[model samples]
Target: MKKNVLLILLFFCLTDAFAQIDIKRTTKDNDLKLSALPYYNYGKGLGITSPDSIFQFNIRFRIQNRATYMQEEGEEAAIDGQVRRLRLRFDGYVGDPRFIYAIQLSFAPGDVGEIKEGENLNIIRDAVIFYRPNKHWNIGFGQTKLPGNRQRVNSSGGLQLTDRTINNAKFNIDRDFGFQVHNQNEHPDKFSYNFRTAITTGEGRNSTDKPDNGLAYTGKVELYPFGSFTKDGAFFEGDLKRETTPKLMVSGAYQYNNKARRTGGQLGDDLFEKKDMKTTFLDAMMKYNGWAAMAAYMKRSAHDPITFNPNDATDIKYIFTGSGFDYQLSYLFPSNYEIIGRFSTQKVNRDIAALAPDTKEYSIGVTKYVWEHAFKAQMEFTLDDMTYLDNTSKQNWYIRFQVEMGI
Candidate 1:
C-alpha cells in the first residue's frame, strides 16, 4: 500500500528528527535562557522558536526522484519511475514578524492530483497567510500560487528543467483559493517594481463544492530593468546568483475566470457548461555573468469555448482555448554546472482544435547545482511536435532524470 504509506512517512520523519534534537540539547544544556533558536541551517530549514518570541517555526522537506523515457511516432517505447515531488513545508511567524505563515504538503502521486468525483486528494500545496506590512507590502490569504506564469511562479524546487514547459503544461494558472495583494519597490541602482493582485475561489485547491458563481480575478505586473537579482535572482531558474550587474525581469498577467468551471481555468476537468475564462501572461527574465534568460507568453479565452452536455450530445468539454510560447536559456557553469534551453509553442482554438493539438517543443537540460537549488541533479531532453485535427503530424521523444533534495 504504497510501501505502507512510505513507512508511515518515515516514522514521522524520524520522530521529528529526534524531537528536534531534544529541543536543541535542552536549550543548550539547561541554560534555559531562551531566545536563541535559529541554528540548523543548510538551506534554512529546521528552526522552531517560541519561548515567548511569539511562535516561529520552519521545517522543510522536498524530494523529487523521477525517470522517464518515451518515444512515439507510431508509439511503443515508454518507461517511467515516480515520486516526482514529495514536499512538506511549514514556515512561520505568528504573533508578529508581520504575522506570516505557510504550509505545504503533498505526498506524490504526481504530487497529489487526479482524484475527483467530488475531490479529496489534492494534498494542499500551500496554505498561505501573510501580512508583511512594511518594506513594500504583502498581504495574502489562504492557498497559494497564482501570480501566474514566470514559469508558473517558479520554484518547482527552482527548476532549470527536468520539468515545466509545454508552455507551463499548457497555460498555467495553477492554484487558487486566494486574496492577495503585494507590492515591492526599489530604485537602489535604479528600477524595480512589482504589483500583484488576486481574488479567487474559481474552484481549485480544495475547492469545497461551490460549482458556480465563479470568481478568480488576478493581475500582476513587475519590472526590474537593472536592479534586483542577487538574492531573489528573478525567482530562481539557473543563474544561481551570478548577476554581477545586468539583470532584468518583466512580467504581466491577467486572468478572469468568472463562471469558469474548470477545463483548465484553475486546472482541468469538471465542466459541462459554465465558461467565461480569460487569461494572458507575458514574461521575461534575464541575468548576467553566468547567463540566464526566459520568455513566456500565454493566452486563453472563452466566449463559447465549447462545453455542451445537456444530457450528452457526445459529451462535449472544450475550453483549453489556447496560445502559448515559452523560451528559456541558461548557463551557470562555475562548476555548479547548468545548461538548459527550451522552446515551446501551442495553439488550440480553432474552437479547441478538435480537442487540442498543435504543439511544438524542444528542450535540453543538464543541471547539477548540488546545493544551489537546495541540492539538485537533472537531465532532460524532449522533442514533441504534434498537430492534429486530422491535419496529422506527430513526433515525440523525451527522456528525463531528476533528483532534488531540500533542507
Candidate 2:
C-alpha cells in the first residue's frame, strides 16, 4: 500500500515539475477531455497458438458514442459513428511547464463492455510517466509508445483515413508492461531516431506468476531523412513526403524464461526443456513519395545446431525456421490518399491447424489521409494461404475495416 502511494506521488511530482514550464499552444487549452475507445472485435486474436492457425488474423471494428450524445438515449451507431476507437485523451501538462501526459484507458470490445469468458480484458493502455527535462531530451516510464513500423506508430485517434490493420494480436501490444526512456526534441516525423528497451515478464498479465529473472528485451530505430527534409521542406505545414524519403526502420527482440513452466500432452516435464526460448523480429519501412513499401520477419523458434542435424539421419527431416515475413505496398493516388496491400508467408514448425509449415498468407489493404496528420481509415481483403511441409496447403479469406482515433 505504501509502495503504491509512493509510486502515485512520484508520478504526480514529475508531471508537476514538467507542467510548470510553459509552451505556446498549451497556453490556450486546458482540461481533461473524455476518452472512449469502443471498437468491436470483429474477429478473435489468432496466431499459431490460435485455433485454426492456418494463416490466422484478428480483425477489429467498433461503434462509439459520447456521454453527451448517450444522454438523449441515442445509440453510437445512430450517428453513423463507426468509430473504431472512442477514447478521448487529455493531451496537456499540469499548471505551467516541465510535464506532459496522455493518461488513457481501454473501452474497446476485448477491453471494456465484455462479459464473456476468455474474452475479458482490461488494461491501462498508456498511463505513461514523462518529463520534458528540456527541449532536446525527455524521459518517462510506463508502457512505452511503439517506435517500429510507421503504420504501426501512427496513433489510433488520428487514423480516420485508415482502419486498424490486422497485426497487434501476434505483434507488439502497442504497449508493454514496463518502463521507458525517450530522447527527442520534437515529434520528428522524418529523419528522427528512437531507442526503446524494456524488461518485462514474458507473461503479459500473469500477476501471480511473479519472477525475479525472466524478461523480454526489445530494441528498434527508425530514420526518415525525408520525413524531416522533404521537397516541401521540414517547416512547411503541408510538406508531405512527396520526395524520395528513405524511411528505414529496424527492430529485434529476445525473450528468456527463468524457471518457466508450460504443459504439453504426453510430454513429461523432463522431456520439455526449460531453456529460455528466443524470438527475433525485424521490420523495414521505405517510401519514395507515392510508392511505399514495408516488411517484417518474426522467428519465434530457430533450429538448435545439435538437435537440428544428425549425421546418421535416415529420413529427410526438413528443419524449420519460424514465422516468416509480412510484406506490403502503396500506390499514391492523385489525392494524397494511398492504396495499400500486404503479403505474408510463414513456415511454422508447430500449429494447431493441420501440421507444421502449413500456412501462407496474402493480404491487400488500402488507406488514405487527406493530410500527413494521423487522420485515416483503412480496410483489407486477406487470403489465408496454407501449406504443409508434406506438400499441402489451404486457403481462406477475411475482410476488415477500422476507424481509429488518437491524440
Candidate 3:
C-alpha cells in the first residue's frame, strides 16, 4: 500500500515537470523558483507559475526526498539512516484570492521502532482550506501545526537552531491536524496577533483514526507593534527581507490532549485521550543585530492519557525547562561565515526517561556568493550529542559541503 501510494506521488511530480506550462500565468508578476537540496539529507523542490486569469489563478507543485546516514552507539561505522519524510504538495488560491487550498501527502518509513515487514503507508501532512477576509483575518480548516513557538513559524529560513527544541518536538509534531485562524494588525503600529483552536484526531499526519476521545487546543500571539519595512507579505527584520525582529514580549499558552486511547506513530498519545493533560509554556525570544536567543519552560501533569495505554490507575508528574540560542555573526574575511549552537536538557518524573533524549549541538559554516548570485557554496560542520532510551548515549561529528547554481 505504501509503495503504491509513493509511486502515484512520484508519477504526478514527473508529469508536472514535463508539462511546465504556466498555463494561467498571473499578469501581476511571474516568480518561478526551483531549489534542490542534495546533502546528507537529500531533497528537491520544483515550482511553476501560470499567466493570471480572471480568477487570479496560480498553481505550484513540489516534491521532496529525504535520506540520512545514522550511526548507532558502540558502532564504528555508520549505516543507512531512516527515510525521514517523502512528500508531495499542491497549493493554489481560489478566485479573487479570497479562498485557498493546500494538500501535502507524505510517505515516511523509519524509526528505531519495530517495523512489521510488508506494512507501508502514506498520510496527509496538511489537507486544509484557508480563507482570507480582507487583509486582517485568515482562517484555515484541516490539520496544521499549532503556532506555539515563533521560530518554528519561520519554516523555510527562520532559525539556525541545530534542531527542534525539547518543548516543540515533545509537545507537538512541528505540526498537527486541526483547524486554525490568524489575524494581523497593520495600522496599530507593527502589531500582529494569532489566535487558533482546533479539534483533531491528535494522531500525527501519518495514521488515521483510533479510539481516543477528546479535542486538542493550542494558540499563540505576537505583539510586534513596531512594523519593519516589509513589502507586500514578505518578511522584514532589522533590514529589508528580514522576518524576525528585536522586540520584548510576554507570551504564554497551553495545549490539551483528551483521548481514551491511541495506537501507533511517534506520538502514541497525540490523539484519543479521555483525560486532559495540559502543558503550559512560557518564554521569550530576543534578537540583537543579527543574532537571537531564546529560553522556554514547560510543566505537564501525569494525568495526561497515553494513546498506547489510557488508565487513571497510573499517575505521575513532570516539569522540564530548555534553553537555546543562535548567532548571525558576519565575518568580514574568509567569505561570509556564521556560528550556531543549541542545547536542551529535560527531566521527567513519571515519564519514560530512557526514550526522552536530551540534545546538544554546535554548527559553524560559511556561504560564498560567487558571480553575484549566479552561484553559491555552503560548508558547515556539526557535532551532535544525544542520550537514548538506553542508559548509555553517543555523539558524532560531521562535515557537509555543498554548492548551488541558479538562472
Candidate 4:
C-alpha cells in the first residue's frame, strides 16, 4: 500500500513537471518569462519572472509518504502507513523586492478538517505578506509559523531524520494569525544578532476568529558568534550544505497566551475553558565541517494550573505543565548520506505525573539525500519508555521509513 501511494505521488509530480509550458512573451508594458523547471530555489515548480522586475511568482508543491511498525510492552506489533503531507505553495513579489507574499495549501487528510465519512481538503498553510524596509527590519502580516522553536519552524521536508522529536508535538506553537517584526544586525568583525516578536490571536492556525478574549505575545533573540549560516541552514538538520567554517547559533524565546483555549498552548484541541499560559524555549545549533549538533529545552506554565466547575461533576482538565528537552547529533558523509542520533525526555508536573507518565525516547537514523532535502529517503529506529508515578514502566519500539519529494 505504501509503495502504491508513493508511486502515484511520484507520477503526479512528474506529470506536473513535464506539463510545464515555456513562454517568453512581451506585452506593451510588461515582459513575462515562465519556465517549467525541475528543481530551483523553491523545488519542482513553475518559475516566473516579470518584466521591469515588477512582479514575480513561483508555483511548487511536495508530498511526504511514510510507513511504520511499532510494538508496545504487551500488544502485538502494529503496521501502519499513509500519506503524511501533500502541500502546494505559491510565492511572489510585487513592484519591489521588499514586498513579498506567500500562500501554501495542504491537501493531506490529517492537515485538513475532520470529515464525517469522507475527506475534505481544508487548504491554506501560510497566507502572509512581508515588507522589508531595509536590511535590518522586516514587517509581516497574516497566518504563518511563529518564531517559537527551532524544530517547530524548520520545514518538515528538510528534516534529517524521518520525523521530529516527540517534544515538539506537545510543546511547540505551530502557527497563528498575527503581525510580526524581524530585526537583524550583522557585524563582520563582531558577533551577529537577530530578533523577532509577534502579537497574535491566541488561537492556532486556520482559526477563523478569536473567540477567546485575550491575545498571545511572543519574542525571540538569537546570536551567531561565527557569523551567520549559509542560507539559514541553522534551521535544518545535518551538515548537508557542508559549511566551510565552524558556525554556531544560540537562541531563546518566550511566549505568553492570556486566556488560551487550548490545553497544549496553541497546538492542541480546545480546553473546557480559557487559561493564561506561558512557555519558554532555549536552543542551540552548531555545525563544523561535516558534523552538526542541536539541543533544545522547553517549559510550560499556567496561571491557573487546574480549574473546577461546581455545577457538574466534570471539571476542566489540568494544564499539563511540564518540561521537555531534546538533543540531536549528525554527521554527513561525502557520499551524500547522513547518520543521526536523537535523545528526548519529557516530565510532567507532580500534580498530574500519576495520570501522565514521564517519557524518554532515543532514536537513530540514516538519510540518503538525493538532492539535499528536496528528494531523500530516510529510515529510523526509536525506543520509547514511559514511567508512571506508581513506578510501573512501559516500553515501545518503533521502526519507520519515509520518502520526501519536494518539487
Q: Write the per-residue lDDT of candidate 4 for residues 31-137, one digit (tens) a residue.
A: 66455433234335776765446777899888999999999999999998988899999988888889999899998886775754442235778999999989999
Residue 165 lDDT in model 4? 84
- Could you tell which candidate, 1 or 2, scores higher by lDDT? 1
Candidate 3 residue runs with Cα over 4 Å from true position: 1-73, 79-88, 107-120, 156-162, 186-189, 228-251, 260-275, 286-289, 294-300, 304-336, 354-407
Screening candidate 1 with a backbone cut-off below 3 angstroms (N, C-alpha, C), the clashing residue pairs are 264-268
**In every candidate, how many clashes are there?**
1, 47, 28, 1
Query: What's the best-to-worst order under TM-score?
Result: 4, 3, 2, 1
Against the reference, the lDDT scores of all candidates come to: 0.83, 0.45, 0.47, 0.85
What are the per-residue Cα lDDT tens digits for candidate 1 across 31-53? 53323344333447887766566
Tell how far residue 316 is off in model 1, in angstroms: 22
User: Each model's TM-score, in the order given?
Assistant: 0.34, 0.58, 0.62, 0.86
Predicted structure 4: clash tally: 1
Please give the distance, in angstroms, between residue 63's alpha carbon in candidate 4 and its true position after superposition. Answer: 0.9
Error of 4 at 270 (Å): 1.1
- Candidate 1 versus the native: TM-score? 0.34
Q: Residue 65 in candidate 3 has what lDDT?
A: 27
Q: Per-residue lDDT for 1-407 in model 2, tens only? A: 99999999999998997676443333357633222212223211211112222222222222332221111112232222333345533333454346655555656553344354543254455665567777655666555443433444555443322333333223332444555555542233645654555555444431233354655554555444434344322221122465454544444444433333221100112112233444455666554556656667765442331121245544222213355667766666667666666666666555322334445656666665643443445665656665666676555555656543232
User: Which runs of model 2 end up more than 4 angstroms from their true locations?
Assistant: 1-84, 111-123, 145-168, 171-174, 184-192, 205-212, 223-275, 302-321, 350-357, 368-379, 401-407
The alpha-carbon lDDT assigned to residue 202 of candidate 3 equals 51
